[model samples]
Target: MNIQNFSVASLLAVITLSGSPLFAKEQTQAPAYEYGMPLDIAQAVRIDEPKSTVCEVGQATMTYVDTHGQIRHVTFLQQTDACAIQ
Candidate 1:
């Protein structure tokens, strides 16, 4: 094959390989809670049932009152049965 054609083929191969999930690194997610970490929930209010999106699963947004009387917003994941404080 000609140099021009070879270069185009090599470019396409590189693009396809780079975009493949097999070559991509697995993303690590942070745990919901840490060991020995104290979390006191004074109150919890569910905002609504969120619609599922491409990047995010369907979850509910909740407002919470902590031990210190601070209001915090958390996303409750139904699949994991856990809440992530935002």
Candidate 2:
């Protein structure tokens, strides 16, 4: 009945409506690929092999589609003395 009480009630109603799911924002999905582990060798499309000083140090690149159907590039590196001549 009081003016002050009526104002407080209106403010509370506004806050509640704003917090409801109908007014909430949508969320985006995360990408399927990230750094760290190597991608599946079978799915990769060999792209390039940059020059290296020796056979022991080799580097190659490839591309493939992730589970999300997004294209991704990956680099492979090898560093070992196995290729060195005795």
Candidate 3:
């Protein structure tokens, strides 16, 4: 039926449009910081900590400028803020 064809076309169109951004959102991933990794941060540009109310561990990210003025980001795991308040 024509209605079935239209529904299929609409579904395909919606799927195609929604799928593009998921790939674009993954532009680049930051380097994960490990224990004993030497860090010499010059100026911290921004810090994005996980936003959660649960008292659990989460991943946090920080953007900083190195001594050479190169912008970089690093990811690390830390306890959420909810744990600190308790």
Best candidate, TM-score: 3
Number of the predicted model whose lDDT against the real structure is largest? 3
83, model 1: CA deviation in Å? 20
What tens-digit string does per-residue lDDT give for candidate 1 at 27-82? 33322434565667788755655544334456565566888897666555553222
TM-score: model 3 vs. ground truth: 0.65
lDDT of each: 0.59, 0.59, 0.90
Instruction: Please list the residue runs of candidate 3 whose C-alpha ends up more than 4 Å from where it truly belongs after superposition.
Output: 1-26
- Model 2 agreement with the true structure over 1-86: per-residue lDDT tens digits: 59999999999999898888644432222223345764644465455655544556565555766666755666566553445543
Per-residue lDDT value at 27 in model 1: 34
Measured with C-alpha atoms, the lDDT of residue 84 in candidate 2 is 53
Error of 2 at 64 (Å): 1.0
Shift of residue 20 alpha carbon in model 2, Å: 37
Cα misplacement distance, residue 38 of candidate 1 (Å): 5.5
User: Model 1: runs farther than 4 Å from truth?
Assistant: 1-38, 51-57, 79-86
